[model samples]
Target: MKPLDTAILLAGVPLASPVTLLSGCVGFCEDLARMEGFDFSAVGAIFLKGTTLQARQGNRPPRVVETQGGMLNAIGLQNPGARHVVDHILPTIQHLPTRFFANIAGSTVAEYGEVARIFDDSPVDGIEINISCPNVKEGGAAFGSDPKVAAHVVETVKRVTSKPVITKLSPNVTDITRVAQAVIDAGTDAISAINTLMGMAIDLEKRRPVLGNGQGGLSGPAIKPVALLQVWRIHQIAGPRGIPIVGQGGITTARDAMEFMVAGATAIGLGTALFRNPLGAREVLDGMVAWGQRLGVANFHEIRGTLNQP
Candidate 1:
């Protein structure tokens, strides 16, 4: 049998590996790249911290709280603004071995467009529309919570950048497929299923929320089931359309990554797993190759969307 081929084309961009270091966890991929055992070429791509039109101070103190099987974070989309990232930061790491994507977020539809427009002129390989951010113009309700608002955000960003647009959906909605269908109609090149679920942690002594922002996004092993279902459902909508899906949420092992691939994720996201093991990407890649060899599968495509449903 032939050796397993992990390489793939994600929304027209060539990816040497299916493992994509997710946004916010890898942080520009600088420090991690400089680590002793880190291999930039081992992963397909890395998404930078969420960037907005302007710099943000982020949320209050105690932004993260650890839970039983996961963690809650309310970082509040803190970043150095879009222009600064495109002008200063992109120049530094654009030459890295792996592709880089700008995860853009904003409080309004226009802000997302402006930010995407900025990155559009840069060397970033692609753009990820982070609709999980609150729409300040609409009384701070999350943009991903409403199908129409999410579609509007995607449409606005799609108009500004020619790069592949991957819309990240939030799991806090009643029906995630509605938002997926809306963005698909709005012309997104790909989809990132199941952004962190909304959750809160309470302080026993203080008698208040553990996170400073009152509520935070939950991620880790606890959310794997939710993430899988979201990816499967989104794939049902995107599969026939030829739109790729980047599956994420609480993947820590190679088996976990394989599960995502079989569920219809063309590319697997490594997020919270990085916090526990910075070198998890390489480990997962090796394990995937071994699993493929054992199963006599030569590539990820064979494993993708092969779930046997009753």
Candidate 2:
């Protein structure tokens, strides 16, 4: 099938493909561009690293640890801040082939609004409100765990930005659908489900946690099942409302992406897979095309929510 035939729209932005680079992975799309044979146009959209109100030093050493079938990270949303991103990063990446999106995070509702406003005036095609960074102490997952707070964040950011606002939900919540509904009601253009689940590793030798922060967010294939369930649950609520879901976590191959699509994810995000292969998105897209051809599927939309229920 043609590339355009596989295209999907997210929050009114037409992506060349349904594959999106997850936030905090691509680092503003520069690092991936430097890799040999990496192509920006291969995917639908690129979500830059998590950007906060001010520059942060991030957590101490041992922020990332490899786990069975997945990895854990507590990067602490380290970023160059919103203003620096608007002034330096966005301009440099304006010519990329795909749509550009900003991943905004803040410690307070006002901070979220301010960051959203900064990116709204910039050249990004959309804004993803990252209310689910598990490593932080105050803002990230703390607000996401509560439906009211998540709704308030969505509402606050929506009021300040004209750009599409996609809310990233935490998997740690008891009832993800409640949070999803709250954000959708608050004017979120789309929903990105199943951010890294909170977890930790221990150093047997040192008798301490592997991560300096004592805990970190677990990601990679290990969370694929959980991600799928969350996506499906949220889709049951948001799909009828015309709000798309960005299903992510543990997606490394075409089969993984298809599983998410079948589970109701309108878009698939590439995160931990990038660490294994910088050109992972291209491979996943190519694999998806091959799978589409084999399955006689004309477009990705046909595979979305095709899961069989008993």
List the global CA lDDT of all models.
Answer: 0.91, 0.88
Please state the error at residue 159 of candidate 2 in Å: 0.3
Candidate 2 lDDT over residue span 192-306, tens digit each: 9889999989999999999999999999989998998899889898889999999999999998998899888889999999888877888898888888887788788888888
Report lDDT (Cα) of residue 29, candidate 1.
72
TM-scores vs. true structure, each candidate: 0.98, 0.95
Error of 2 at 29 (Å): 1.7
User: What is residue 122's positional error in candidate 1, in angstroms?
Assistant: 0.4
Residue pairs clashing in model 2 are: 220-250, 221-250
* Superposition error at 71 for model 1 (Å): 0.4
Q: Write the per-residue lDDT of candidate 1 for residues 152-187, one digit (tens) a residue.
A: 998899888899999999999999989999999999
Ten-residue region with minimum lDDT total, candidate 2 = 132-141
Model 1: lDDT of residue 208: 92
